[model samples]
Target: MQTTNNTVLITGGSTGIGLAIAEVLIKAGNEVIICGRRESKLLEAKQKFPQLHTRVCDVAQKSAREELYQWATSEFPHINMLFNNAGIQKEIDFLTGASGLYDEESEIETNLVATIHLSALFIPHFLQQQKECAVANVTSGLAFIPLKIVPVYCATKAGLHSFSISLRSQLAKTNVRVFEIAPPIVKTELHREAQARKQSQRGIAAPAVAEATIRALKNNHYETIIGEANVLKGASRIAPKFFHNLLNKVATG
Candidate 1:
């Protein structure tokens, strides 16, 4: 798909991968609208990039997602791209059984449910567009290989990965192009705040992932697994047990 001149809406666009994508897309001359739950964060992003359109809607709630779709479509009828980028990551120690009930809900709601529901809400609108349209779901390397500490987060991504495959098949005959961009660990507030300082710093830059995504979208790659994520995916397919042990060891150590 052509990158420039398309009106795109990105969820959780205030920071991290979402914000990075918004910045790059804006630079490419695309009309970018970003939605998040935090008004302050949205304004901060807007301050950084005056051209970015901001919306405060938590996609985790069904009502909020619906409202966002209605508002965005009405405000920007030409919007033809949806980036399901909103997500949360937390380290849950299931062994200790200390994780709260709300933790599971937050991860599932934001990561998996919101992605599916938002995509459903936007697909028909995209199909009505006079030009080519696309939907890109931002999953993670954890989808292929689970990090035991963040079980729910990994599971949610894995679910998104599976859903993307089914979604692409269903929309194969339609005008919408479905893409799944699974990123490796990136140095962002989301990752940094959830892990130890050293491990967090070891991540790839969010902008690097954004650049790779742009290149993949330009090349029409349906499954854009970036950087070390590709290694994880390969390892998962080749030696699941070994990788699982290795990853868990590193995570715990």
Candidate 2:
């Protein structure tokens, strides 16, 4: 897929990895629109990149997702790319029973369900276009190897990975290309809960992931796994048990 001259919509574009991607795409000469739940962050991001079109939409809500699709497509009819980057992570201990699972925002809904729904909403529009289009899903290294502390988040990412594979195969005969980007731990606000528990959060910078994304898109790489994520992906297939134990051991230690 060509990297420039395309209009793109990115969910959760206010900060971190999403913001990094927005910066790269904008610099690459693509018209980028970003939506997030927080108005303050959206304003902040807009202030930084005045060219970015900002919208406040919570992807976890069905109504908001529908509204976002309508508003974006209506506003930018030439939109050819969708980045399902909005996600939330939580550290839940299922051993404490259902108490730990009852949160106002669900990881499954935000990370997995929203991505699937957004893809479904945009695909038909993409199919009708004469030009090429793409849907890039932001998954995690944990999708391949479960992290004991963030079980739900890991599961959601795993589901997303599976969905991306199936979606890519189904769309193979079409102009729409499905890409999966799996990045390892990065220095971002997503790891706040784990950081509060004093877990090591040292990882690559967000721009590294963004740069990898650009390279992947330009090279037509469907599954782009960055940094330590490459190791996790390989280990998951080659030595699942050993890596699973080692990963959780280090995460819990």
Best by TM-score: 2
lDDT of 2 by residue, 149-191 (tens): 8899999999999999999999999999999999999888898
Span of ten consecutive residues with least summed lDDT in model 2: 193-202
What TM-score goes with each of the models? 0.96, 0.98
What local lDDT score does residue 149 receive in model 2, on the 0 to 100 scale? 85
In model 1, the Cα lDDT at residue 148 comes to 86
CA-lDDT, candidates in order? 0.90, 0.94
Give Cα distance to truth, residue 60, candidate 2, Å.
0.5
* Local accuracy of candidate 1 as per-residue lDDT tens digits, 1-253: 8999999999999999999999999999999999999999999999999999999998889999999999999999999999999999887777777555385349889999999999989999998888889999999998998988789899999999999999999999988999999998898877854456466656888899899889978999999998878889999999998998998888667
Clashes counted in candidate 1 amount to 0
Give me candidate 2's TM-score against the actual structure.
0.98
